[model samples]
Target: MELSRRIKSLPRYLFAELDRKKQALRQQGRELIDLSIGDPDLPTPQGIIDKMSEEIRDPRNHRYPDYEGLLEFREAVASWYWRRFGVSLDPSTEVMALIGSKEGIAHLPLAFVDPGDYVFVPDPGYPVYRASTILSGGIPYTLPLREERGFLPDLRDVPSEVAARAKVLFLNYPNNPTGATATREFFREAVAFAREYDLIVCHDAAYSELYFESPPPSFLSVEGAKDVGVEFHSLSKTFRMTGWRIGFVVGNAAVLSGLGRVKTNVDSGVFNAIQRTSIWVLQGNMDGEVEGWRQELRRRRDVMVEGLRSLGFKVEPPKATFYLWLKVPEGYTSRDFAERLLEAGVVVTPGVGFGEWGEGYVRMALTVTEGQLREALRRLREVKL
Candidate 1:
């Protein structure tokens, strides 16, 4: 059998490679404390589970779902967007339910890009952005996010010629692996940048609801943002519903329609029962419940950041998300540090797996219990830099 050229373009997924290393250590009977992935370790809200269980019994939800989604679910999404980020959306044309934000984020490139088109992606970013661009046969241009720029891409450095050929630009705030957040002013600047380039912006706001101190601002909260972009929201992190696969997109109606067109031909929509439960959670006033989750995350953040700092790693505590981005110790490359730790029964993601520029760093996810995190830190102490 022959493989497709598109399938050949992607590198091995960063997490999958890390998992292989983890499994090898497990075979040796090592007790491991893993912090390699950002999957939440918390339980889903009981109310959401009850709602889904109840809806599943109804025969109306047994058939294939609407291509767009259940109408009520779409309306709840618009209402939630307005209440959460002050971004008003039109339910009928501007919103579309996704199996998850990742599904929409990956498929969107296929809908808008041509084989020769350019796609702008942040280096040291989530692997899906670059892989999806490659799968769509689009040329990917790397935009470096240095610490001096607060880990945000500089619009001034983006060449006008590249922008002219680019079909889409991806930005993620309350970012994964890096744990960085973007400001409203930054989003406003992005809106102007996308407008000047005559291209679409794809903001991956998956971690928007997982902030520690303040809620992260949405790209759509900026004035004129709807003129050029759309934001992908996920229930995976926010609701700890990673396995449920329910999410939605809000912003530029035309771009969403294009993504919807692609989705309609590729697969079925989210299960109707899942959509109904998501709608219930959205409409129920979940502010206090979500904030409680953030409080728990904040406590975990303090423990990990302080423990690392005590061991002499110069890392700033992240204001949002549940990941820590740390520089590798002196004389050790990212992979060497990770490999050393893996042998000590602690697993982490080596940064170079994200990109060439990520070579000197490593990412630690705070998904483990405090006791486990402390155990991992103790294991690092044994490495002694």
Candidate 2:
């Protein structure tokens, strides 16, 4: 009863491990105000729910969906890209629906990376990027992200040997854990680097619609970007449809086809009803509703930033995404700080869970209600930093 070697190399999932600790504390009758995971506390908009209900009753939808996706859904995704980022996509060959952006990202490595190939990933990034690479039997080369560089890695710093063997580079802007956004100039440099190194760029733009200032640039927005990059978008964050499991990938035709090949073999498609609802969401029918959610998140971000600062933690307000990445107080490891915070009835994620470079930070998710956030802050204030 031996496990696969790939499965054996995987580290324990941070959130799952944290949940065990949280459950233990809750069993002791401690009221835990969890801010660890970035799941939105808000309800799905009525429009989206109503759309799903309507589709579910239509008997035709009971059949398995197209392996690519419903044509209407793909068209809506193409239209959204053109309107939002000026990136034109052909629904026929350049777009494919995903169960979620994470599903697409995780499966893509299997499409492009062979065993023993290298996949460059950002340290202090979402763990799935590295985990997926490892699961696909590709070696992961961590590119350290530091605050001194605005949390963006400098590609020039990568050793020539690593770049030579690399097949894919994973990047996320309006980044999770750190909440850092990339600029157009930065993306231009990345595009140039990828061209020189002959690597495919996998850009995770799940938070594109959640920004506070300027909209984050998509990899497809750059000139000639489609030649070497693929971008993934999700309805989870933007439309508050995390449970719906709908997203899309658009960019290089070859890459999209590679992902499609893997998908056809592994999945039927997203549920027809969910794809129908996603069409409405992407077509701006839900814009007002989504905007309202954004405003609420913006307010929560302000509250959390101010509250943490008042408690003597140097917290920077995130420009995008509903996360606050704060340095752990002096003399405490990120995991130790997270554990202490949990003991204080506030559940935050340890930065080390993201990567070794994340060791000195803690990520606080503003996914709870304003009242819950205030209480969590109050409890945090009582703890000595």
Candidate 3:
């Protein structure tokens, strides 16, 4: 059977390919320490689990959910945003629940991009931004996030003609892979750029709550930002609720309406029981619990950073997110270095899997236990790299 053009055009997902390599090593009797994916090792907070346990038993939640999610959940989201980022949102128009932020991000291009229209995507970014743009028949214009510039895209470098032709701008702070955080000043610059180009900004703030020092600012917190774009947030990293598939997008009401329209036809909304539990968690006092999780992640980050530094790989401890983006050693390409690590029973993601510009780096996720990280370090110490 002939595959659909879109399906044929897609590259195998980065993690899926990594899983294949991991399985091959496991088959060889290697007990690998995987640092390839950023899935949290910690369990979801017990309060959220108990809330879900209670909500799931109610038969009322056994049917189709509201297309935009329950009003209570949306309100809870708005409340959480106000409390967390000091950004105001209208529950009815400015907020919409997603099965996960990935779901929302993948569908966003379909809402605004046309065939051949441009999408400004950061190179070395979350792969979904580029992949989804392709699926929607959009052209993804690469915006390299160089380390010298703190991994933030240079808006000034975007050519005038490209900006004129672009439809959407995707930005992720506390970025995946790089773990770079954005400041309000940088967001202000982005908001200005989007306004000039008449483009919709889609800020993937999934890692907003995972910081080590100062909290990251929301794009919507900048003046007139809500006039230009939306922010997609997930509970996955913040609460270690990756399995829950609960997240939301908030900002310009019209932009959200367009995304909501696409969602209504393509899929059912998030599970009602999960939505209920999300509401409970959003409204409940869980700051201390979340902070405790942050502390543990910080501990793991220090261990990985120190271990890598000892081996002569100069890696900075990221300000947020559980990832360490390190440059490959002198004689090795990203993939070659990754292959070397895999041979030593340590799995890491090759940066080139993210994009052409990611060629010289490899991203190591700090999602394993400290003991596992130490073991991975021990394994690395034996490799002659």
- TM-score of predicted model 3? 0.97
Cα lDDT, all candidates: 0.88, 0.90, 0.92
Q: For residues 224-316, what per-residue lDDT tens digits would candidate 2 score against the true structure?
A: 789889999999998888998988899999998998899999999998988887887788999999789889989999998888888877877
Q: Given candidate 3, what's the lDDT at residue 317?
A: 93
- Model 3 has an lDDT value of 0.92
The alpha-carbon deviation from the true structure for residue 76 of candidate 2, after best TM-score superposition, in angstroms, is 0.7
**Per the 3 Å backbone cut-off, how many clashing residue pairs does candidate 3 have?**
0
Best by lDDT: 3
TM agreement with the true structure for every prediction: 0.97, 0.98, 0.97
Clashing pairs in 2: none
lDDT value, residue 35 of candidate 2: 89
The digit string of per-residue lDDT tens for model 1 on 6-55 reads: 89778766566557778877888878988887898988888788888999
The 10 consecutive residues of candidate 2 with the worst lDDT sum are 10-19
Predicted structure 2, TM vs. truth:
0.98
Off by over 4 Å in 3: 12-21
